[model samples]
Target: MNSPYSQKIVQPDISLTICGYSKVLEIVSNKWTGLVIYAMEDGIIRYGDMRRRIEGISKKMLTQTLRQLERDGLVNRKITPAVPPIVEYSLSGLGESLLVPMKALNQWTKENYSQVELARENYDRINSGE
Candidate 1:
């Protein structure tokens, strides 16, 4: 049976313009990246240090996010040729600019968590008839 939703997917046309929300979302949408950036805010400069602070983040994901941030000119990676290797990651000037806004976001989330929890409870109660 033919269904209206079963049509073959086609790429939608996009103009050569970027939206502000898209730009912000692109930078901050990665779950691990935001935590990494927040961790770096408090002088976290070493690879192992960041990994430890952001518990459960896999090495591969951390590496990939760091690379992406570096490519986006948000973070700087320094390598020291010690006996094995000493590498440090820190925010670049451009990256530091984001800290204020990110911190605001963090603060807002903290402030609104109680309201969010209440909303969720109300939603669950209404939906479950309990």
Candidate 2:
């Protein structure tokens, strides 16, 4: 029996179990993906600039995140020939669509940031018996 997700008219080219949670995980499970998206939302579109914007993220992590975003068609990578070399990363048309949702999420974070900080402090205090 074909699953509901299976194509009806045009048969799917690939067969796999892609649950909703799994799909969401694939998009935002990475620690750096949200940060990368937020950074891009600010109009900075260069590799070095991104590196600086997202502090503490190693080159390898950023490279991996960029590759994933590119593969997912959420980002565009442009290579420019110069005295040395220049590479840039920017959001694609589809990716810009994500800005609204991301911005909303950011707003929620800002609203709850203080509560989260207090909770962390309380947890630490209780655990430390202080």
Candidate 3:
């Protein structure tokens, strides 16, 4: 019962391509990465405001994530000369392209989270001999 998607995945080149592309997955694999991306979805936002929007993330973590995103060309950072030297962040064109798929994943998570939780619980129970 191999569908087109599965069949394509079976191809050697396609499998290698996916392996190569997994780096992109690692870039966004952290919990904070997606939240940071979503926080900037509307438009440019100040660093302080972004920090506030993404609760529980430490300043160090935010700074690290933003730096990584900028380095990857997925986010743009701007600095304004001021008393405090204001810093702003926004999604780059690449980041904007990533948002469409991210939003789809978010929606999928919202829709299927219960099923995921159930599966996790079942797995844990079975593994624990409960």
Candidate 4:
């Protein structure tokens, strides 16, 4: 029996052949992207501050993620004219717009995570053959 969920997975129309939504997800749905966005939610943050705030992120990965976000126009990188050159990052208007939905999703996950954990526990017990 085909479920409604399965039926809903139709291909995009010709006009949407490029799958713009998918492209956006490709940019934002990575493991570190959301965390980086959340870290900048307060305001502009320096590179060192962001790296310290987001635990478990390597210097290389954070650098790569920041570059990708800047390339996608979701983040703004500013370089100060000081001797050592201070670099800071902040969300662009587009990034702020994207945050609304991402915040909603974050709230939903917090609310439902316990239920999801319980479901996983039940599934594991059922399949344990014990």
TM-score of each: 0.81, 0.70, 0.83, 0.82
Q: What is candidate 2's lDDT per residue for 1-130, written digit by digit as tens?
A: 9787666657654444556656755787798998897778755388988999998999999999999998999898988999667888888887788778777878999999899999999999889964
Clash count for candidate 3 is: 0
- Could you tell me which residue pairs clash in candidate 3? none
| Candidate 1: segments with Cα more than 4 A from true spot | 1-17
How do the candidates rank by TM-score, highest first? 3, 4, 1, 2
User: Model 1 — which ten-residue stretch has the worst lDDT?
Assistant: 11-20
Rank all candidate structures by their lDDT, best first, as comma-separated numbers.
3, 4, 1, 2
Question: Alpha-carbon error at 28 in model 4, in Å?
Answer: 2.1
Judged by whole-model lDDT over C-alpha atoms, candidate 1 comes out at 0.87
> What are the per-residue Cα lDDT tens digits for candidate 3 across 1-130?
8576664454355453467568778888988999999999999999999999998999999999999999999999999999999999999999999999889999999999999999999999889964
Q: How far is candidate 3 from the true structure (C-alpha RMSD, Å)?
A: 3.8
Model 4: per-residue Cα lDDT over 1-130, one tens digit each: 9776666557646343487877767878799999999999988999999999999999999999999999999999999999889999999999899899899888999999999999999999999996
Query: In order, what lDDT does every prediction score?
Result: 0.87, 0.83, 0.92, 0.91
Number of the top lDDT candidate: 3
What does the lDDT read for residue 82 in candidate 2? 94
Instruction: Report lDDT (Cα) of residue 130, candidate 4.
Output: 66
